[model samples]
Target: MTSHQPPLWRRAVAEMLGTALLVCIVVGSGIAAQQLSPNDVGLQLLQNSTATVLGLTVLILMFGPVSGAHFNPVVSLADWLLGRRSRTGLTLAELGTYVVAQMVGGIGGSVLANAMFEVGTSISAKDRATAGTLLGEVVATAGLVLLIFSLAATRRGILAAPAVGAYIGAAYWFTSSTSFANPAVTVGRIFSDTFAGIAPSSVPGFVLAQLVGAAVGVGLLVLLFPAASRMADDVVVPHPSQKDGS
Candidate 1:
C-alpha cells in the first residue's frame, strides 16, 4: 500500500458517517421543505433541491479526503471496476465492504432523519415507481456515473465535489423521478413517508433502474475516457494527509 493511502477500515467508517449525514440532510430538508411550503409543491421542490445541492457539496469536500466521500454503492463499484487497470481506486474485496457500509449508513441516516422529524421509522407510503420514472432513473444514474467517473478517470477528482452536487441538483429538476441516482439513497428513502420518501414496493424497481443506469454509465465512461489507468489513486477523491504506512 502506498504511504498516502488511508486504510480500508478507516475509509469504510468515513463512508458510513458521510452517508448517514447525507441522508439526514436529504430527508430532513425534504421534511422541512414540505412544512415550509405546505401549499406549494414547486416551492417545496426548490427548497429541497437547494438544500441537497449545498449539503452534498459540503459533504463531499468534508469526507472526500477520508473515504473519497463515496456514500453511493454504485460509485464504489465503478471505482473498483475502473481501478482494475492501474489498481488505483478500490480492489474487488473493498467494493463489497464499501457497499455494505454505505447500505448500513443509508438506512441509519433515514431512521435518524425520521426520528428527528417525529416519524419514527415508518415505511414510506409514497409508491412512486412507474414506467416513466424507471426511465428517468436510468438517465439520472447514467449521467451521474458518467460525470463522476469521467472526472476521476481524467485526474480531475478535485472538481467532483461541486460538480457532483451540481449535477444531482440539476437532475432533481430535469429528471422525472427527481434523480434518486444512488441505490443506497433509494433504499434509504423507504424509511420515511414524507416528500422525499419512496414506497417499499418501489425499492426493487428503483434499485434495478439504478443498477442499469450504472452499467450504462460505465459503458459511456469507457467509451469516452477509454483509460482507467489515468486515475490519480486507488480511491475516488483520494485522501489527504493520511499515509498507508504498509
Candidate 2:
C-alpha cells in the first residue's frame, strides 16, 4: 500500500459491498418495475432501466475510489490482463480474491432482494438462454468493455460514472438479453425468480457469450486504441490499486 491507499482487505470489502449493492439495485428495481407496471412489460423495462442507470452511476461514484467499482468479473479479468505487462492493476492473487468476493456479493444480493420482495429463494424458471439472447450478451459485454477501456485510454476516466451508466441503460433497450453484461449479475439473477431472473440452464450459455464478448472488446480496444494498456489501471475509475503495486 502507498500513501493514502487502502489495504488489500479494505479493497476486498469494497468490491464485495459494491457488487452486492449493484445486484441489489438491479434485482430490487426489477421486482418493483414488475409490480408497478403489471400490465406493461415495456413500461416495466423502462422503470428498471431508469433505476439501474441512476443507481449504477451512484454506486460507481461511491466505490470507484476504493476498488475501481468493477462489480463484474469480466472487468476485473480484463484489468488483470491489461495490467500484467505494466504491473499496474490487479495481480493474479488479487484477481482471485476479487473474483471470489464479487461472486459472493452477487449471490448475497440476489437473496437479499428476494427477501425484500417477499419472494422465495428458488431457481429461476425464466429460460432466456436462446441463440438470440446469447448473441445479445456478446454485443452487450463487448460494448461495455470497449466503452470502459476506451474512456480510460482516452484519459477521460473522469466521465466513467455517467458514461458507463448511460451505456448500460442504452444497452438494456438495444440488446436482446436486456444487457446482463456482467457475469456476476448474470449468475445472481439465477437465484431470483423475479422479472430479472434467469434459468440455471441458461447461465452457461450466457457466461460463455460474455467471455467471448470480453475478448471481442479487448480486440477492439487494441485495434482502436493501441495504447489502451497504458490506462489499464484506470478502468471505470482511477484507484489506488495501480499505484499500490499489488
Candidate 3:
C-alpha cells in the first residue's frame, strides 16, 4: 500500500504553519518567562526550555506526516542531501520552497508573538556573539542532526518527536548559546527583545555556525550509519509502506 502524499502546495502550507507555530512558542514563551521570572535568569531559561520542549514535540507530531515538519532550514537541506541519491528526498524546487516557507513563517511568528504581548515589533539588543556561543551552536546543531538521522537509520523513527524535543531541552542547559540550532528560529529571535532574542549583528554568525554544524552532522551520520537505509521523509511518522507490511 502506498501512502497518499499531499500536493506540493499543501505540504508547503504545512511547513509554513508549523514553523510559524514553533517560533510563536519560542518567542512567546521567552516573553512570558521574562515577565514571570524577572530576576532569575536561570529560572527564565528553565521555563523557556520547558515550553520549547513541549511545543516542539506537539508541532512535530501534528505536522510530520504532512511536510516532514522540518521547521528548520538545515534539517530540510540535510534531508535533501541524504536522499538525493535515491530520489526519495526533496527535489531542489521543494527544498527551496520549504526553506522559504520556514523563514517567512519564523518571522511572522515572532511578530505575532510580540503583538500578542502588546510589545510592538522591535529589534533585539541582545548580542550573542562569542567564541564559546558559536562553538556551542555548532555542537548543538550537529548533535540535533545526528540524533534525527540516527533514529531513521535504526528504524526507530517513531521516537523522533520525543527524542528530538528531549535533546533540545537538554541542549538548552548544556550549550552556551541555548541551542538555537535552527537558522529560521535564530532569525525570528532577532525580532524579539525578550530573553530568547539574538541581536541582528549576531544572526549571520549563528546561521553560519548552524550550517557548519549541519555539515558535521551529515558527516557523522555517514560515518556512524554507513549503510544506506530508507530514511523517512517524516521521522516521527512512518510512511504507509513502513506501517503496513506491503
Candidate 4:
C-alpha cells in the first residue's frame, strides 16, 4: 500500500506551523526560565534546554511525516543540495517555500511568545556579538548539520527525531552561543527580549557564522560518509518504507 503524501500547500503549512511552535517553545521556555530561576544562570539554562529538547522531539514526531519537520532553513537547503543529483529531495521551488515559511513562522512565533507573557513586542537587547560567540555559532551549526546528514546517510533515519533533540540539548550546554543552530530561529530570536533573544545588531554575524558552518558540515559529510547506500526521504521524517513495515 502506498502511503498518502500531503500536497505542497499542506506540507508548507505544516512547516510554517511546526517552525512557529518550535520558536514558541524556545522563547517561551527561555522567558519562563528567566522568571523562575532569577538567581542562578545555570538553572535558567538547564530549564530552558530541557523544555527545548522535549518540545522539539514532540514537534518532529508530530510533523515529520507531513513536511519533514524542517523548522530550519539550513536543514532544508542542505537537503536540497545533497539530493539534487538524485532528484528525490525538495525541488528549488519547494526549497524557497520552506525557507520563507520558516522565516515568517519564526517571527510570528516570537511575537506570540512575547504576547503570551504580556512582554509586548520589543527588540532584543541582548548582544551576542563577539569573536568567540561567532566561532561558537559556526561550530554549533556545523555539528548540527553534520549530525543530521550523517544519520540519514547511515540509514539511521529513524533515530533522527530523538537524536536531533538530544544533540541540540547537549549543544545548549557545550556551545558558547547556546547553539542557536537554525537561521530562522536566530532571526526570530531578535524580536524577543527574553533570555533566548539576541540583539538585532548581532543577527548578521550569527547568520553568517551559521552559513559558514553549513558549508563546513557538507564538507565533513563528504569526507566521513562518502557513499551512503541510500538517502532518507527527509532529514527528520521517516520514509513510507520505514513506516509501513516494508
**What is the per-residue lDDT of model 2 for residues 78-142, given as tens digits with 9 covering 90 to 100?**
98898877666777887888899998999999999999999889999999988999999999999
lDDT tens digits, residues 85-155, model 4? 66556778888999999999999999999989888778999999799888888899899889888888887
Give a tens-digit lDDT track for model 3, residues 159-185: 889999999999999999999999999
RMSD per model, one decimal:
2.0, 1.4, 3.1, 3.3
Best lDDT goes to which candidate? 2
TM-score leader: 2
Overall local distance difference test of candidate 2: 0.89
List the candidates' TM-scores in order: 0.94, 0.96, 0.94, 0.93
User: Model 1: how far is 145 from its true place, Å?
Assistant: 0.9
Candidate 3 local Cα displacement, residue 44, angstroms: 0.3
Ranking by TM-score: 2, 3, 1, 4
Candidate 1 segments whose C-alpha is farther than 4 A from its true place: 232-235, 240-246
Residues 109-143, candidate 1: write the lDDT tens digits. 99998888887788999988999999999999999
For each candidate in the order shown, give its overall lDDT on alpha carbons. 0.85, 0.89, 0.86, 0.86
Error of 1 at 18 (Å): 0.9
lDDT comparison, 2 vs 4, better candidate: 2
